[model samples]
Target: MKKEILNCEKARSICIVQTLAKLGHFPNRKSEKEAWFLSPLRSETQASFKVSLKLNRWYDHGAGIGGNVIDLVCLIKQCSIKEALHLLNDESIPFTTEAPVSYPDNSGIEILSVKKLQHPALLDYLKSRGIDYKIASRYCYEVNYTCKGKKYFAIGLQNRSGGYELRNKFYKNGSSPKDISLFKTNQTSLIICEGLFDLLSLLSYSPTLATIHDFLVLNSVAYIKRTTKLLTDYKAIYLYLDRDNAGRKATQYLLTQNPHCKDMSNLYEGFNDLNDWWLFQKQQSG
Candidate 1:
């Protein structure tokens, strides 16, 4: 008998609504672009989870987190990405019989322009964050986009799903298709961070450490459940989350799942986060 092995990327591309249906989660209501469901992650009387067929993603408004099919599976099954893939692979039944849905006409936001990180205002913002100009240029871009008929711009950090997390002095939000930013170095061990700035701070302060291991930035605490599943292959998962309530809770959750997961937040014991610690060190040297 030929064994059927599942491809992780292929499995992730599967329609989320279809997958949810396979797991007995039919949508409570549907439109051309979105399907609403009572959140499968948590028990609630009202439906709060929305699946965007146009984007092939899901966002639980109550949780304030969103991601792709892999993330959805991880959230639903409480299993690692590899384990979810395994379970999905074993199921031989077709998840959906319908034809591919067309891309929706109204995406709500439009990318007006994308260019190199050369804007003075954005450069100054990076300086304020204590991130080096060279480092910022390598991982970020200057993005201009339109939403609700208004134009805006921000320093954009692209995630694995081609979505950008936008940040500026005045505005802080993510563009559609919210997802985690992953830097894969083919290393067995990995270090996970909570934000892009934190990852940059680590790179600036400890370039050697940054290069030696892979990195994953949660971008938001709500992503912790989905992010945990991606860490299964790492031999040592070092968490450098902020010393805040959300961070502490996420770290505890990961530790519970894998007792060997290391908590490196002690390195900045008295500070708010890695960036805060790095800024303090810079001030002290001057």
Candidate 2:
């Protein structure tokens, strides 16, 4: 038998819909569960893109297409199912078998727990991530709570379930588990990155590339096993992994798996990734 997929709650917690909405997609509104936005699928005027907050669903009035959260991300991002969850961290959502209830009791839920975050603290945390306050404020919030005998902070994102995704701002780097986000549009070229931050950081360095080529964030070396298939479909593949041992190993492994995989590591041999390389270049120029 095949391994069972995680629940809706778990899926919702990690999905980046909230972030995407806040960044530029969904407009902020209260009372109504539906949100209006410019259709990401196509450019049009008059805000035909609609997202349902209560149902955690979305629809493009212009395109006459509508779907739940998962459907929207898959279409918007053009990623595989596994890669989609990895990109959005949709696995962060939490759910149980119990029937619908007014309030959920989040005592020992794993992954990201939204019940522990402080509202103001979360806003501050987003600022630290270099995400604009106004943008983040539109989608994220801090959940109120006291856990055990001590107080804990969590970043809350709305979900199909009543719970939120909670990640502490102070966790050790690389301590958290890794996930991959892969996308392959019909474009002729492919651009890869080490992680989500690095991928997003690329937007700052090469804004044009963001729209011109299909992008993939390996999320980690572990995901390379599942990425070879994506390689076969693209005409050109670029490896933008880190300069460290793990990144090198991943890049080499990919080449071995698919002869088409290119070692673009030369572009950032000095730094860990494009972002670091860009930052270093900025310092040198200054």
Candidate 3:
């Protein structure tokens, strides 16, 4: 019965934005990727909660929690996961899989090859970022692909959705299913980074730190809403976002939701980001 319920939840996973609308909670603002709504979880006048149309996930910024359709139902209905599934199964509530959501098309991007990160260009790129090739290899690869009829290659870091976030000296992009990359250590604490390079820089700075705490890399700040759901299980969340406006806002948003969230950006003060700070240190020391 549990297996059947889980399968049903996966198969009938509904678009959360539509669900919100059905609940009479329309978004105040929306875009191609996400929608912002006044959080239904609490009495918030400001629309801080958001729903990712492509990912079919919702994050309640006020509550610092998020999840899939089942999780959302569970929260709103104050029921168990099993009860949430039952509620979703009711005929009165409509859950359709036909809604069109704007997501990146990966069909144009063909991964021609993937191998060890031994390419000199990629190694040099890592060196330029002050990240060790050895550490990078553990989490990244040399990916050769063609997109829009042009051939390209880069260091690829795979996200939880099985898509690659590619980076190099000249290109920074990702394949379809853009999602977060979670490195779990079975620990209660987590270090959240805004980009893959920052995660790599931290690992390179202290290899032992990887063993003590987990890490989450959001390929883009646009996914910060989706991140709130993943962070609920952790007792501590350390933010290492960029020093830019978007990064600062995201950090403040998360800190508002999760009081335990600590700002680690101070460690790299005066630099644009963690990787930039690490590179500057390496250049000065060398």
lDDT of each: 0.78, 0.55, 0.77
lDDT of 3 by residue, 1-286 (tens): 3333445546347667766665567889999999999876555578988898888888775444567876776545444567666666554666333332222343345677899998888999998888988889988999987664557888999889887888887555566666888988699999999888999998888888887898898887778888878778899999999998878998998999887799999999998899889888888899
Q: Per-residue lDDT for 162-280 in model 2, tens only?
A: 43333335321111123345544578788877664466455555657746778776544655776776778877787788887778888889878876678877876777776677666
TM-scores for every predicted model: 0.63, 0.44, 0.63
Local distance difference test, candidate 1: 0.78
**Candidate 2 wrong stretches, greater than 4 Å:** 1-169, 172-178, 282-286
What would the TM-score be for candidate 2 when compared with the true structure?
Answer: 0.44
Candidate 3, residue 159: the lDDT equals 87
Kindly give the stretch of ten consecutive residues in candidate 3 with the minimal lDDT sum: 95-104
* Deviation from truth (RMSD, Å), model 2: 18.7
Which residue runs does candidate 1 get wrong by more than 4 Å?
A: 1-108
Each candidate: RMSD: 17.0, 18.7, 16.7
Model 3 ranges off by over 4 Å = 1-107
> How well does candidate 3 match the true structure in TM-score terms?
0.63
For model 2, give the 10-residue run with minimal summed lDDT: 170-179
